[model samples]
Target chain A: MEMTVLIGLDAASYILTLLLVCIGLVIIFGMMNVVNLAHGEFFLLGAYTVVLLQQYALPFAVILLIAFVVVALVGLVIEELVIRRIYHRFLDTILATWGISLALKQLVIVLFGPGSQQAVAPFAEPVAMFGITYSSYRLFVMGMAILITAATFFILFRTRVGLTARGVIANRQMAACLGVNTRRVDRLTFAFGSGLAGLAGAIMAPLMSVDPQMGVGFLVPAFLSVLVGGTASPLGALWGAGIIGGSNSVVAAIWTPVVAQIAVFSIAIVVIRLWPGGVTGKRKR
Target chain B: MSGYSRQLTVLFWAALIASPLFLDGWNLGLLSQLMIYGIFALSLAFIWGQGGLLCFGQSLFFGLGAYAMALTTKDMIPGIPATTLTGLGLAVILPAVVAGLLGLALFKGRGLYGAYFGIVTLSAAVIAERLAINWSYIGGFNGLLDIPPLRVGWGSWQTELYDPLPFFFVVLVAALGIYLLLLRLERSAFGTVLRGIRDNETRATFLGFETAEYKAAAFAVSGAIAGLAGALFAVQFAFVSPAILGFALATEVLIWVAIGGKTVLLAAFIGAVAVKSVENVLSDTLGQYWLLVLGLLFVVAVVLMPRGLLAPFLQLPLPRALRLSGSKEE
Candidate 1:
């Protein structure tokens, strides 16, 4: 009974983490049609924010907020300088973002040196459920994931910014004609996406070893989730995160972690082969 | 080719051929590595420039070739002999088959849009790298080492190319051969058809051409050439690792081809050599920050000059013999 409960919790945690890492991508890729290859680097930047500032002994929540704001500001700067000019050119944007990714990674290495850094978990005590013990930090991560995902959903669907962003996403020219500042919408959308990625990094920093190359590990899976979700709706990201993350966790229960990873990738490949537009299909306009 | 471009090509080849006469052992070895990378860049140029496909997983083929060569030469396979020739053949053939099958799968139906295709390839390369790390049979994460040097001649009468000069000549011959063959193909009717499909796939299909098959063929050929480069690299470096077959190298090659000018084969070739050469100098002076400079250059080039820095200067008109008569299209 304990093993089963643990397994269920593990799978759930995996799904939540995957969702947190990829929700930002859904906003950026789905809404703007911009493939920000530097997204993973943005994530790493958040992780670094936690790593570097924690020495001051600040509260974790405050640091987390700082990570989000700092990364969003960085995103805003990048948007003005690089992404804004090439929004219409898909291939060019990819290459340019890839360049940015490289530059950010190297910058991290220069600043932090080549060694991996660790973050102390804020909630260290183990919580018991169904006669099994689990790290409270893990539980916190799960709650945070749910909370942020819900907040993002509300912000994208219920708020005015969300409405304008949706309007721009649906049809940029139409939105522009309706007195919406489409350019501002694009900039904010990108920064919000990037900010979410940074938040994810900060949340995850305590759970894993943090390094300059940490982003690369998460990049493929996150991109795969978004790719499988398509650029149609935020719901596409939810469905993608659930399916890919769910399958990976279940596979990890039965097999070696490496095999589980391979299975997840193979499943993604097969899925893509069958449904090239992704699991959600194209947007309904 | 135009008179100016022809003269430029001749001068370039002449300089490379005579380089070994003046250079010492160390420089010759460096040049050999550059030539190998040139071949790798050329493969990407063929697919991206000619077939209009930007494959983000190109190193998958190159790494496949390296491992294939290393395994074969190390006698890791059951029946196959560990000969240089066998390694070379399998290196070329394996990647070609993989690329052909993948191209077929990807290019079928409406086909993946450019960015979508690139992401899928990127995923494929990362998956391959993970598998390599997990599979202990192929040395797991440490990768294969102690691969033998290239040897020529039959049974008891073989000679190994341990010296830099002889190895340089061998690489030169191979690079020149691949370049000429690719150049010939570029000027052929099939090449024109491929370019047409590239300019507009729907129009080419409407004009009664099998666009998928053409793309698959181009991918296969590119993969084969990349495998050749990988095999040569394995022999030269005497090692093969998962990093060579993964996303990092894939991105590195993209930067090289993008900087050099993917449209013209020679430009891409020179791009690889020049970039690698500059990296050697800059990495020493600027330390690791050199990557930032390169990244800035890459972003600027892609945003402002998609044709690449050298492409505009080197994109000469096709030779009269190679040109499709009355087809004035670029």
Candidate 2:
């Protein structure tokens, strides 16, 4: 009974973390047709931010906010400079961002050396949950994932930016003609989406040693979740994350992580092949 | 074609043929390896330039080719011949078959295109890399080594090509053969349909052509060429590792094609050779900063010269018979 409970919690935490990682990718790809291959780097930057903040002994909230802001600004600058120049040029955008991803990863290596850094978790303790003791940090991550997803949902639906997004998404020309700063909208959407990725990194950094190559590890799973879930809506992203993360966690529990990785990748590819529209059932536009 | 370009082409081939005179054995071997990469780059150029498919996981096929050669020559796979010729044949055929099958999955029904297609290929390459690392039968992380070099003739008359002179000429001939083959296709009627599908798939579909089959054919041919290059690499390096078929190599090949000129086959080939030469020169001095420099150069190359840095100087005019822009079949 205890093992089953523990496994269920592990599965839920993984699914939520995946959802957090994927929301930004889904939003950026769905809102503006720009595929930011460097989205992984944004997450890396966030994780490193937590490592930097470790010396200062700052509160976890401050560290998360700073990571988000710093990476969001980086995203904004990148969008204005590289991404803005190549709108609707799909291949060019992918290349430019991939170039950025490489450069940023190398830059981190140059700065921090090739070794992984450790960050101390603030809530490193055991908590009793459903009559089973679990790592509190894991539970905290689960909460943060939920809170961030909810916050993102509220921002998109209840805020002005969401309204502007809907307007622009419905008709870019119409929105631009009606005094909407469509370019700024693109800028903010990219920044916010990147900020979410950064937040994911900061929140999850304590679980794993932060490294220059950490981004590539998470990058594929986030991509798979977004691809399998269809980049149509946040709900789709959550659904995709659940399927991916649930299957992966369950498989990892049974087999080795290497096998789980292989299984999930094969499943994702087969899923994409059989259901070209993804599990969300939304056809590619 | 311009008079100057044809002259340049003749001069270039002449210089390549006579390179064994001025260059030593070491430099000749190095140049031969770079030429092999040029062949690999040409495969990408054909698929991306002609078929409008930017296969980010092209190294997957290249790696498969290398393994095919390695396993066959090592006599690891039961019931297969352990000769270089058999290795080379399997190297080409295996990747072609895998590419053909993958094309069936990716290019069917709604079909993945643009970023979706690129991302999927990237994931597939990553997955293959992981599997290669874990599969103990293939040497796992340590990789396979000590593969035999190219041997010619029937049974007892075979002479191993351990020296650089004979190998250099062989690589040169192979590169030239693939180049002419691709150029011939580029000038043929099939090339027209390919360019048409690349520019606008929907229009080609409306015109009653099976774009999927055309794309799959191009992919398989590209895979075959890439596999051939991989076989050459395995023979030259005498080792095969998971790194050969992963993200690192895929990115390197992309940079080569991007810097060379995606549309022009010769320019793309030069892109690989030029980049490899630059790396050979700079890696000693720059050390770890080489990747940073390369990454920045790739970004600049993509931004300022999307057609490739070498494309403009090398864009020879098409044969008059194949030119389609003047109220004809372009």
- What TM-score does the predicted chain A of each candidate obtain versus native chain A? 0.97, 0.96
Best by lDDT: 1
Two-chain complex of model 2, DockQ on C-alpha atoms against the true structure: 0.74
- Per-residue error at B257 for model 2, in Å? 0.5
DockQ of each: 0.63, 0.74
Across residues B201-269, which tens digit of lDDT does each residue of candidate 2 receive?
Answer: 999999989888889988999999999999999999999999998998998899999988898898899
TM-score of chain B of each: 0.97, 0.96
Q: Candidate 2: where is the Cα deviation over 4 Å?
A: B1-3, B324-330
Name the fnat for model 1. 0.74
Off by over 4 Å in 1: A283-285, B1-3, B319-330
Residue-level error in angstroms, candidate 1, position B182: 1.4
